[model samples]
Structures are given as structure tokens and as C-alpha cells.
Target: MSDSFPLQKLQNITTPFYYYDMELLERTLKTVSEEAQKHGFVVHYAIKSNANPRVLEMIRSFGLGVDCVSGFEVQRALDAGFKASGIVFAGVGKADWEIELGLDNDIACFNVESVPELEIINDLAAQRGKTANVAIRINPNVNAKTHHYITTGLKENKFGINQWDLEKVTDALNKMKNIKLEGIHFHIGSQITDLSSFQDLCVRVNEIHEWFVSQHLAPRVINVGGGLGIDYEDPDQNPIPDFEGYFKVFKEGLNLRGDQEVHFELGRSITGQAGSLITKVLYIKEGVKTKFAIVDGGMTELIRPALYQAYHKIENLSSAAPEEKYDVVGPICESSDSFGKAVSLPRTSRGDLVAVRSAGAYGEVMASQYNLRNIPASAYSDQL
Candidate 1:
């Protein structure tokens, strides 16, 4: 499946819409399954990344499980035809209603982040006459070597339970009757390109595993939550991430028990390259230092650039003119709405088609009606 967009077809559709390459998506899923199955690792698609119905349904059809961070996502996964037994819930601030929803659905496990959350899930499960399977989310303090905002496993970050509080967590687990201890979960951060960080995590988990055995506890699962990164600079050159190498890291690093199953909650690596934000050039404004290619899509359409200063390769599909430097920006009022500063693209003009590559994961899912702008529509390769 080619990542290139059809400018003629895109011209007929509305501007600032998502264009998904379903063929690419399918191939990516197949690769992920092949690699994960090689090591007998189970993968759960993180719904927080992209909950588009079509995307979710395709993932479900691949026989992958769902990893939800909220009650609504759990319902979304269910509505998309993912089985309740294959769904796993993980969040730091799960509301009471969310816990009830999970209990009613009998989700595979809830990755408990704190003692209070563990207690609440237990209470909710008891009220429902069900036992909630839970995995304690541990803060291993391992650096993911990525952006600070997305780094989650550090002790200072408000994500997993700190190492110092393991004793309290175990004690709370012993007292929480309605909850069944299932495993240990860790998600250090997002968009992690460094493999060494995962190796560090494996070492930490081995140490933590010994601690659990010392306490006479053996878990049935070991969930090393996913943070695999994708190449944003050259999506076509490296459309699919190095799944073989990625799974190999865990195969070699992690210490697994005979009865335990290893699981991963992958998001971006699976979907990032399969979607692009197709926007039309609204105007061309001459600036002091650089020309501005003003696009209809803004922070509202794709917020990753404005939110995390994330990079997405920008292309001008309508022109084959000599390469020219431009500051690709959106119509939003905020200064941070710029997609790429000093982006080199073909000399562009009004109504030129521009494609923002590598937006499948957090693009449409995180879009908003900010500025009262109508939410952008989506187009798929199959449909177009």
C-alpha cells in the first residue's frame, strides 16, 4: 500500500481531512502479529492512541486485544467487536463508574496504579459480585530517553507506583479481597526510539520479580507496556517500524516464568504511518525570513505538533517545482499551531495539496472543535 495521496481525489473532498491507508494499516498489523507471536507475546491495541471505529475494527479483526484507559474507550472497544476477555484497562485516575463498567464487562485486567485505586476497584467488584483481576503498575524510574512531557516511569512522574511504595502495594493487595493479583505492568513513556531504555526496564523488572517471589507471590502475567516509536521524518522510507527488532529486545531481555504470559500495549508503532492529514493550502503569505504556507488544518485538526512540538514530514503533492523553504502553519490563532518551521517543500501556492505524514495514532483522536471550527472529516483508501 502506497502512502502517497491522490491529489485529484483529495481535491474533490473537503480540506483538512484525514486520509487513512487501510492497506498499509493491514500490513502493519500483520507484521506486528507475526513478530509478537514469535515470542508468544500478546499485544493489546491502546485505544487512547486512535479510537476511530474503522481503525479499531480492523485491529480487532486481526485477533488483537484492546488496551483501554477509560470507561468510554472500553465501551468503544466493545462496540468495535473486541471481546471483554481480551480487553485490559489501565489508568492512573479511573473513576468509580469506569471501575463498574470494567467489572460488568469482566475485562481481562485492570492495571492498578495506586492503593486507593486498588481499593476502589475491589469495592466496586465486590458490589458487582465479581473478582477484578489486577496488575500493579510499577514506576521503575527508568528513563525512556524521550520528551519530558511524555516520560511516565520516572519517580517524579505521577504515573505508576514508586519503588519505595512496593511494600504498601503488596500489603493493600493482601487485604483487597475482591481483587485478584494478576501481574505487574510498566509503561515508561511514549515515542521511545531508544531500545536501551527497554533493556533497562527488563533489568528492573527482574529485580522486582525477585522481590515478589520473596513475598511468596507469583504473577500469571508480566505486562511491559509498549512505547515503541516510529520514524516521522521519512514515513515512506520506513513505513513499518522495526517490529522484529522490537520484539527481539523483550525476547532477550525479560526474565519470564514458565506459567507467565508477556503482554504489550502498543499504540503509535502500529498506526502512526498508516494515516496522513491532508490539507489544502489556503493562502501564501510572504514573511521576513521565510514564506508561510497557511493551511486549513490547524492545532484543532492535528495537535501533536502544537502540543509536543512533534515532527511530521510535510509534503506538497500538488507541485513539482524546485524545493523551497516554508513555515507550514495552520489557521489557528495560537503561535504554536505551526506544523514545521523551515520545512523544505516544492514552491507552493493557494489550493495546493499538502500532506502531513505520520498522523495515524494521535492525529484525529486528539483533534478538537477548538475555535469552534468543525471537526475535520476522514477519508480512507478503500473509500476513496
Candidate 2:
């Protein structure tokens, strides 16, 4: 976060684009790896969050595994140099062909979400004459208390196999000789800031582990899926998440068997705050009761503001005199393509750089060419 970098760089580059702080990203990765190593837990970066090749390579330098939600993500992870033994393929509706791809690649594990998905993998493994290792993704009905769209552990969400179906799921696994139930996985949700939610998740995991033990199936692994959140309000203040508290929640709450391995699938907390959507203000339209600081970047560049109504702590980087209230908006044709309403800034002016912070996760990866708008090109700080 050099004082001169953003403002000076903004003057030379196009108005709207993604600007990455590689130094920040490297620091974040170091912090995560160090914390995760303390508990002897295996961390798999969720590639679905942000698959930028540069970001992937930087993260891969940390020697972390990858957690993939799609066949493309699996392929991307491998293409990014992640080993086959380090990829965990997880998705609710994995196609049969994708199962074959995993089997062909011999990925580390498949986080099967349903009995049918497990059966499909079993059937596929039999064709390939291989034993497929899997962990049943259980919806423990735990609430992450985050945004509704990101909340996945709820009963109604089409994320994991519910408790009521566990018996049938376990029975299906037992009947299938080729699919080995290596462990049980739980992913509550994403962008979860509350540490208490993780504690609750661990408690639930312990109870589920106990239940599995009662059924003569104590798994040697307990994967508490990652949703630890980074600070959007104050990114620099909280560069790293409370990894000590997050991992410790599982330590105090989960009942682990001897020689058991633990795992996590953290995504946002690792990269979200390290990047920003830099867009120059095109027009500062003043209204009777409100002001709109229109910028070139719209929902096309970063959809979190429109899709999730999410906050990113926008800042007028080029202004330093005083702050004023204005609605930071985008150039998209849709009325919904807005970043912030009544947002206060440093009394912004046209051509001033407006940075939408904490955008590394779903920013560039989710960019679109809607309304025939050119998808914003990206520029990393190191590249500059």
C-alpha cells in the first residue's frame, strides 16, 4: 500500500480496471500458511473464488493445495501447477464426465454432496478399475450468519446432504465397493466474520463425528470447510483474519481421533482485501437530495455490489482534502448497476480514482461483457 502507487498509476492507465497489490497478497498467504501449519491442518485454496493465473501462481508458491468446485476449476488448478494429489473436487451436481476426469487424474478426494453423486462416482470408479476416495459433504444445518446468497449450510440450501439422508447415504457408501468414505466435510458458508459461527460449526462437526462413530464409521479426517472472513471496513487494520481464534475454535470444539487429519478451504480471507476495482469518476451528478459519483466500472467489473448488495468500503484515492456524501455508481445501462448510495468520500471530482476495496475474490473472475461493454482489462502492480 505505497502512498504514491495508486494515484500515480491511475493517471497513466485507463479509468476502470482491476489493480492488485501483490505485496499484500503475498503477506496474506504467508499469514494463512503459518497459522494453518500450527494445527497441522491441510489448507486447500478454493479456486472458484478467484482463478487469476497470477494470483494462483503466487498462492501456489506457498505450497498450498486446492479445493475445486467445478471440472474447469480442477483443470485450472492443475494447469496452475497444483498436483493431482492436492486437489479436492467438490460440487453438488458433478457431471458423470467430470467424475471420470477426477478418476483419470486421481485427485486427492471428492467431497460428494449427495447419495446419488456418491453412487455416480462409485459407478465411474468401477469403470476405471480404481478406488475413489471421498468425503461426504454434510449440511449440518449450521448458520454462518453471513449473506443469504453465501449461506450454504442451511437445510434448504442445495449444498450438502442433510442429516435425515445420512443413513441412506452411508448405506449407499457401504454398498459401493469402489468408493471409499475417507472422511466427512462441512462447509457452512462464506464471508463469515463471526468467530462464534466457527465454534458452532466445530461443535456440530463433533456431534456428527460422534454419530458416525456410533454407526461404526469414525473417519480419520474431519474437514471443517473454510468461511473465515477478512475485514471490509478496515482492510489494512485487519490484514489477516483471526486464524488463531478460527483454528482454535475447532481445537476446543471438535473431538478429533488420534492421528486424524484436519482440513480447510479458505478463499476470500486470503485474497479479497488484497485487490481493488479502480475506476475513475466520469461524472459527479448532483441531485436535490442525493449525489451520484458515476464511474466507468459497473456491474460488469465487480458484481458484488449489485448481486449481493455487498459492501467494499469505497475510497476516493485521488482526493485528500475533505469528505462528502455521494452515491458512487457505474456506467452500466441497468438501473441496478450501482456501487454505493449516499457514500461519503473526499469531496470527489471527475477523473478522481475511486477504488472499490476488497474485490480480489469475486471481482475479475466474475466480470461480464453485458450491454456490449468491454470487460475491463486488469493490471497487477508488479506488472506495472
Q: Model 1, range 183-238, lDDT digits (tens) per residue?
A: 99999999998899999999999899889988988988999999999999889999
Best by TM-score: 1
Global local distance difference test of model 1: 0.92
TM-score of every candidate relative to the true structure = 0.98, 0.97
What value does the lDDT take at residue 50 in candidate 1? 94
In Å, residue 250's CA in model 2 sits off its true spot by 1.1
True-vs-predicted CA distance for residue 260, candidate 1, Å:
0.6
Q: Which residue pairs overlap in candidate 2's backbone?
A: none
On residues 284-307, what C-alpha lDDT tens digit does candidate 2 reach at each position?
898999988989899999999899
